[model samples]
Target: MHYLLPARLDLQAHLSAWPPTEVPQFHPDALVRLLHLVTEVPAHNRKLAKQIRQQGGYVPLSAQLLQSIERHYNHYLTYAVRSGLLETDGRWWPTTAQVAGKCRGYRFTAAYCTPHPDASSDEVARQPRLQLVHLTDPKMQAKARRQGRRPTLLSPAERRDLRLREQPHAPLLEWLAPNRTPLRLDQAAALAYLAERFDMLPPVVAPRPKWPEWRPKWLKALDRDYYASPVEQYNQRLHSIVRLANRQLQPSIDTTVGRLHTTLTNMSSELRPFVYADGYGPLVSIDLVNSQPYLANLLWNPAFYTKSSSVKSTINFQNFRQSEIYKGRNVKGIIKEIPDIMLVNISQLTHREDIRLFSSFTGSGQFYELLLNAFRQRDVTLTTRKEVKELVFQVLFTRNGYYSPYKALFCLLFPTVDHIFRLLKQQDHTLLPRLLQALEAYLFLHVISRRVARTWPQVPLFTVHDSLVVPQEYAGQVEQIVREELRQATGIEPTLKHEQWSQAVRHDLLPPTSVASSIELNKKNR
Candidate 1:
């Protein structure tokens, strides 16, 4: 186990980059890498490192490598101890047997699952090394197929056998949920519906309040309030952070504002000509065009009417209103309904506890109810970043996002409060709707073929605000469906951000090329 690493590393290149005279006696980065390698490589020694060395096995460990390993031993060994993977003996020692055992197990498991039968039950039972307790029925290889690795017992159904889809263990994913729900609050109805949540919904990140120290005005105003020792001096530190956060918010707003406008334009017109009217007949005056009748022709005249939403979809002037056909999914549910308003709450916490409950008017149980109702009522989709990933974003945002000078509203605010306020103000105003759409697409992908649905399917035409500019292929029917779903999802009529957006493309914000081509959708795109 004390084997020296077979060093295939470029000793000359390292020397040239950092001449030994200018460099420390040992290379810190190299030492660090060696430490990490020795720490994670079970049953590892310098010789084992040599085995993993990419060089054609020609080189032996060098003084520099040995020096680095020696210098960084403590750091590496400490990490190894915490990882439960190595032991410290003035050098990080990998569990050589553990590494080999796991790999051998995996190999045997893999070999067993291969098409060719390697052994019978009687033969496997005789091999003491092959533990067959969890996987007795050799022929029923569902687990093996699902895992697609080890030959286990009865094959599970395809739906239940998504064994390969699990994400690796990450500490942040460990959010505390009393049951299946994330931390939330509840009040006995009789105690008071007119309590904390009544004033405003509890913050999504708020922990229970410590009301005694530098109490919030609202809490003090309560005729009857409870006492808890709050950390008030920390308010100064939080306020300072908020000021810094404001400085950072302006640039993001500027960046996102441009994207919002760009997407809007693409939805309205610029991308239109590329996708639509590839060979559709030339447009003359609609009044004049109405005189002709065929598969496509306008019958009613007095056109260019903005008053009628139906006219835009028509194959000809008279048939616009009749064009829409397909209904959007999820815009309505069978038994429940809810409004479109997005609710947001953010509270700064003094204690980062394991049980971090975000108080709620209705407990998290109500979240299920709300979701069921929403699911049952409409066919709209929603989007969210992975919880751990989102929390990381939150931390970043808290540090440098959404707190700024132009955002004078958040002055003297806590980072958490400002962070929430800005998320609702900027993102909820525009991105929330889009995020909802992303959520729907994600669910569709999960329920359908995760990879296939994610990469290929879902005809997302294009989007502007909550409205999407679908292809003219669905040309006549797309608008009607969007309108229908918009009504059901947001309780508001949705309009196509653009029409004939493809035909007219100009960034100078010039007037429409001609009166005939000046569609409304084209107008918003510019």
Candidate 2:
């Protein structure tokens, strides 16, 4: 059974004829936008049209103008398909069914030919064609009309209200390719078990938690909903987790905005504990400690190299690996101090005595507390350990030569660590955040994911950026494997932390009530 797949149409040739007859007014800007939407990005036809209309400035595209444009667009497709210039299967996946593995619409095969008037026949024949896809379905046409009637933009207040009402969830629109290899039997069973448990789980109905007083002003301004009621925010996260679990699980990578965003990776930390494999016990999460800063330290370690002509050595590298830093410190304590020590070393300041004093404070392994005390001494109004940690993150994640607006605060807090930011930008023109992200992806996909697949083939391992969630029994082995992989990949010893489901459950940390119960309570209260 052969399907009549759509071939590309030569619209440019028809439009560029010597004396054009009844060619529709297809604006160049509109055509370009349409081509981008269909071929490159690949959105639904109605969505593509709405996006084009929304782009119009001053006065938005009028209903009549929009209708006319869509009409011409549809007419072009119809004519091309009918005349055999363009081909199609004459069938379409319904808009509702498109999410369920029916993504195929009209695909672009060839370009529209715009022959030069002075050019020979050979030149005309050699004209390159544009490859594009077009959707020509009655349902899509109806959807477009409905969407046109809807308002495109919302006021700030309306947007805030909408955010409050709707659950905050990343879109789970990506579908795995059908031709991709299937998951192993064990892997498939584990995923299926997790999916079932996730679907059956109830929503959380907990007491509203206090908002963090030390949250950055900028972050507070951006996500008011999160700050307003942390418990409600958590409930929304639970709903998102359920939705993510409901998605089709397969061994395929889905990328968005140059980063991997697969269904498993997108699961929030709050929801990870609830994930379970049938035969294996509840999941445990093991994550790299201070992963981004660790990478940055690795990148800029050479800057601290000493040249005495007789013998050359790096002070930072040697100090970092020394047991003296961890003398009284446990893993967590050592991890917490690494950022501050790295900052002091990387800054390349002239005041070596002051740097040494700051290093002593960091080496105390109570960096955040001491840093907060230092800020208080300088009259810099920082309250919590979290706030100090956020400040450290702000410095570490700063991009290519661009000083954060919070520079004054950071400089006042850590007076001698200003040069480290400049050195990071000098080391790489590309921003540290992007470089760190690429490295993280490489580490997760290449090292961690592969190791899990090979060593514990039956175990259901999931990734969340720098962390991996696996069965609790295998947590120690997984952590060891991850550390070994990181050492092999970057030659840096990695610090690891684990969160067990048993611990969380024993502490009554997981939300006590199910979603259905929460909904019922809300109804009763109303």
Best by TM-score: 2
Error of 1 at 428 (Å): 16
The models' CA-based lDDT, in order, is: 0.25, 0.42
Q: Estimate each model's TM-score.
A: 0.20, 0.42
The per-residue C-alpha lDDT of model 1 at residue 497 equals 32
**What are the runs in model 2 whose C-alpha is more than 4 Å off?**
1-241, 244-259, 302-370, 373-379, 396-406, 409-420, 423-430, 485-494, 502-526
Lowest lDDT 10-mer window, candidate 2? 166-175
User: What value of lDDT does candidate 1 attain over all alpha carbons?
Assistant: 0.25
lDDT of 2 by residue, 243-319 (tens): 23332232222221123444345445555444454344456778776676555433433333322222232222333
TM-score of candidate 2 relative to the true fold:
0.42
Number of the top lDDT candidate: 2
Candidate 2, 83: how far from true, in Å? 38
